[model samples]
Target: MATENNVLLTDTADGVVTLTLNRPDQFNALSEALLAALQDSLAAIAQDDSVRCVVLAANGRAFCAGHDLKQMRANPDQRYYEQLFAQCGRVMQSIVNLPVPVIAKVHGMATAAGCQLVASCDLAIAADTAKFAVSGINVGLFCSTPAVALTRNVSAKKAFEMLMTGQFISADDAAAQGLINHAVPLDQLDAQVDALVQTICAKSPVAVRTGKGMFQRQRVMSLGDAYDYAGQVMAQNMMAEDVAEGIDAFTQKRHPVWKGR
Candidate 1:
């Protein structure tokens, strides 16, 4: 386990790393320091072979309330705002670019950039009582950055409505709209997330890594291009030693011991 000024906490077990945002008093707002901690931690995790999955969790009643509005108001400089937003963008992209899957364990309200954080993850599981919103509109600042992720996770009309009205949606509504994979009772949140983590950990790490990369890369390609790219990736994956071992183990009617290539 590792901790950063008690602002962020990291724990690894059974090939899963859980990063918990620890600023409960601040509602785990993405302050510059917190963002820096997250960025550094994610970069480190990207290079860690022992980790097969990551869970982004929070330690507060509100998962996150987005950027530190009070800090932004204090600075009020265009340059500062630009840098801050850019930093936040990098953090979101890091989650997307991670070789292993990232799951957001949403247990409370995720507003503005917080909502974007959930959307940016590869998968998300939310507690039934959790809420989500791109709520900067209420403060006269358009949630432009969050909208990038919001639109990708949900329909344009639904994204637009949330952006325009700054209304909060229930966790079940988020799941229905494809923003989250599941919405379970608060007490079951940990078990649901753990199930996913365990399943991913049990797979061949190399295949999961290659598949995750292919999934992200193919998302933006034209249909024909996607197929072409996927075919090449699949061909390459087939050549991996792990695949051979997996197939042999299946044919032999026994559990496979993955080498992870």
Candidate 2:
């Protein structure tokens, strides 16, 4: 377990690393410091083979309120804004580039960049009472950065509506719209997330890694290229020791003893 800058906290157990945004007072806003902390943590996790899964969880009443407006306003310079956004973009990209999958555990408000964080994750689960929006439009600023991730998860029209209208949607609505995987009662949120984590952790690490990497990369490729690439990935996956064990165990009617990494 580790806490950095008192803005981010990390704990790992049973191969799952939970990175918690610790700024409860600010609704866990993406302050510059917090973004830097996340970047560092993510980089470290990318190289950590011991970690099989990541849970992007947060503390406090709101999951996140987006950028630290006060901090941004304090340095109201074009150069500052450009650098700030670029930094934020890198952090988001890092999440997508991570070898292991990340699951966002959302509660309360997840607005603007907060919502982007959820969308950037490989999977997300939210409390039914949670609310989400790309509400920068209300402040006369289009959520351009958030849009990149949002549009990838949601339909163009639906994502545009959220960006243009700045209207909050319920967690169930978010799930239905594909912004989140599931929305459960607040009390059941942890259980649901834990169940999902366990389900993923039970699989062969090599298969999970190979599949996640190929899944994202193949999305942007042409249909023919995608199939050709997927075939290569699958062929490589078949060569893993765990795959052999997995098939053998299935044939023998026994649980697989996974040793892949």
Candidate 3:
């Protein structure tokens, strides 16, 4: 039987795993099932040695509208919301802490927790027609969950303004604010994402994984500590087989063939 916790669609190719939010009718809102599915997908991806990158995308006109308000209204239980947010947080944290890089492919509206999802990813690409907002304040509910990722990705003042105003911003605006890496026409979104994934996949997977981990770990540390940590990581990576192969390829003036070692 199709399970409640299996709402997410996953596809893997060339070391990239794309996870799609599948609740189209609700604009891909985060329901208990969707949230659980996201967590499960991330957990599985983390253990899969073949997967080196993840792309979080959606199938609806809206990337996500945040939590499933109808479900919350029907249940009318604060405990339910609590549990849902907790699970959502775990999923977001998994993206941030994953050794593989994650990219958010934003196609339409991304609001509230949806906007936070983009912020949590290591890189984000959006269609020029897409928009983003922290709209919780509009409904008299502050977006506490989304704030965790949003605040970290952009400056505190910028993040606070978006949340407090509850206003929508264009994809270009999002890119300018550092919320996304690039914004292209809607028709070009897939091609752009594919190009990006291919570029990342062409690199040494082992170095990519190690470097991504180091970037996450050192970002939260003091400058000296970060340098010390990076030095250790670089020293270790220098001895890896991929590094040796890369050096040999450079000496021979040829494209390096990565074994993903």
Candidate 4:
């Protein structure tokens, strides 16, 4: 659905929600209004059990160009900057906190906070022509905010190189550095993203939701703690009716009918 201003467009089908960033003329920069819209959309989707997956896509020549530089300059104050970054951070974290999986579909340049957006998603599929960079340094900023998610997705050395040098990396390099899941030709970008979405949608929703949460939580834990947490999650998952159905169907050589318990 198109927002009042049409800055963001959303469409849902087959249990998948597609959130498309509009404002192509501005390279889909994250203006305050756009951020608010996105925040609201994510919040709504989080509560919508019907949504099994979300695709974060964009229109125009660039996926996103980071924060609105003009708007930033317009209000050059410490408090304003702090609030803006905080708002952006909330939006990014919402994606991680969402029970369902989120996939970034990148087809053009994604810079600064844009790159951060890609890093924040659980999965990212970029087109061969897509480019990524944390280029805030080029404009006298340090990309400190974007670095939060960027550091988590890639190695410290590689993340620092991009943040400090403000250089762009090809989609293939992004995938190699673990910043994205895969890089395909521009023509296949949609199909590749859809394929992943379909795969996730085919799974039991309850299992996928539990697994996604466990995956994120374990990432920040010690190895031993991770295993402990994982074991608990597995035990809980086994108690779900879907698990029994899945096992029985497997042994019986029949397709499992998931109740999403």
Candidate 5:
């Protein structure tokens, strides 16, 4: 994925995979090829057992400005727009559906669907100077799709306000609004992201994967149904070798050596 002029670049180290958006000149806009690349990479990561975590980073000064507006203007077809939005939605859902956690390493600005990318992630860490917005309305278009992910991550009123006003918020405000996990100095952004990645990598991969799937599925369930489903999941988790090893390690006052991912 690191080929010359590749729209997406990928690197893996220490059970962590970093996927970098490579459209620097275009501010990492999610063009058609870029969207396809993202979907393909995420699909592959879903099956890769060695990948304990994923970091979504960008190469440019701007994280992502959103969809490729020029491309959209070139087509100007309703059907094409429908398919494009659908594809973008799948990419967002793919992030939420991936077995391992995805952390957005945000810098500069992330607006519209770019901000949706941050929302789709399980966690996000942004530089203090980074900015976020759902600014489709500024162009006379509504950010209907980004609103889906945004509202799920942030309060309904705040999400609506961003959509309506087309205003940007600083990274710290994004964190306070629940759109991102933390915002640190630009120089320390990588360190903060790495600290979180290391923490996740230290946990049992089996438990992490199982919990992620269950957490997503049970969110839409009724209270009683959610409890029932969680109980079943926990019961099954107890049977995993890693769980047994973890309990044994706790009793023995030692670190657990996980057996399965």
Candidate 6:
């Protein structure tokens, strides 16, 4: 039997944990319930060292259509929008800051905050039929929340174009712009993501954690400071048992047994 969490379906096996957003009828839009569910899921996974990798997917035609517009329309008040966007920001931050690697599995349209969700992941793979957009501008509302992650993933000029035009872009364009890693046929989406996850999950979890953390933290630092910070991290990682075992295994020509230290 599958153990399901509210707003999400979670399954753990082979060092990989898959978390699927469950509101397919709404294209898995982010509502208060979905946000709360995701927050708790991330927090729980953070505590489980056995979870070496995370696959963020959804059960829907569209991976995510962005924030629940119905909720936004009902609220109307600026304060409601502020609070909702704030929660979206927090969820994105959690995904990026989480210790384990997160891979976004996108199969269809991922617009507005949905695009932000894809960008927030450490890596993303989309299907050939997939489409992406930041179309909030079409409705006279800028996709400010999405801009936060999109700008970091794509070049400044490219990101601005997407935000300003709100035009839909194909999966190929997303990968070329660095917003997504790979794009394959819809039929191959699962295999593609699974292979990518396997490639990452085979690595030493400790090293992966250190590398992911360093990568996330160094993005905004000055070049010199970034190098210095990375050096310190390298030194610290070197002293960890996992690193020592890894090195020894290389010399002995044997598979490394990671202790997750």
Q: For candidate 1, write residues 48-147 as lDDT tens digits.
A: 8888999999997989999999999999899999999999999999999999999999999999999999999999999999999999999999999999
What are the TM-scores, per candidate, against the unseen true structure? 0.98, 0.98, 0.95, 0.98, 0.97, 0.97
lDDT of 2: 0.95
Q: How would you encode candidate 2's per-residue C-alpha lDDT over 129-167 as one tens digit per residue?
A: 999999999999999999999999999999999999999
- Please estimate how well model 5 matches the true structure, expressed as its whole-model Cα lDDT: 0.94
Instruction: Report the number of backbone clashes for model 1.
Output: 0
| Candidate 2: clashing pairs of residues | none
User: Poorest 10 consecutive residues of model 3 by lDDT?
Assistant: 1-10
Q: Cα lDDT for residue 27, model 2?
A: 98
Displacement of the residue 115 alpha carbon in candidate 2, Å: 0.4
- Against the unseen true structure, what C-alpha lDDT does each candidate score? 0.95, 0.95, 0.90, 0.95, 0.94, 0.92
Candidate 6 per-residue C-alpha lDDT over 199-244 given as tens digits, one digit per residue, 9 for 90 to 100: 8888888899999999999999999999999999999999999999
In candidate 4, list every pair of residues with a backbone clash: 1-10
> Which candidate, 5 or 6, would have the higher lDDT against the true structure?
5
Encode model 4's per-residue lDDT on 218-247: one tens digit a residue: 999999999999999999999999999999
Off by over 4 Å in 2: 2-4
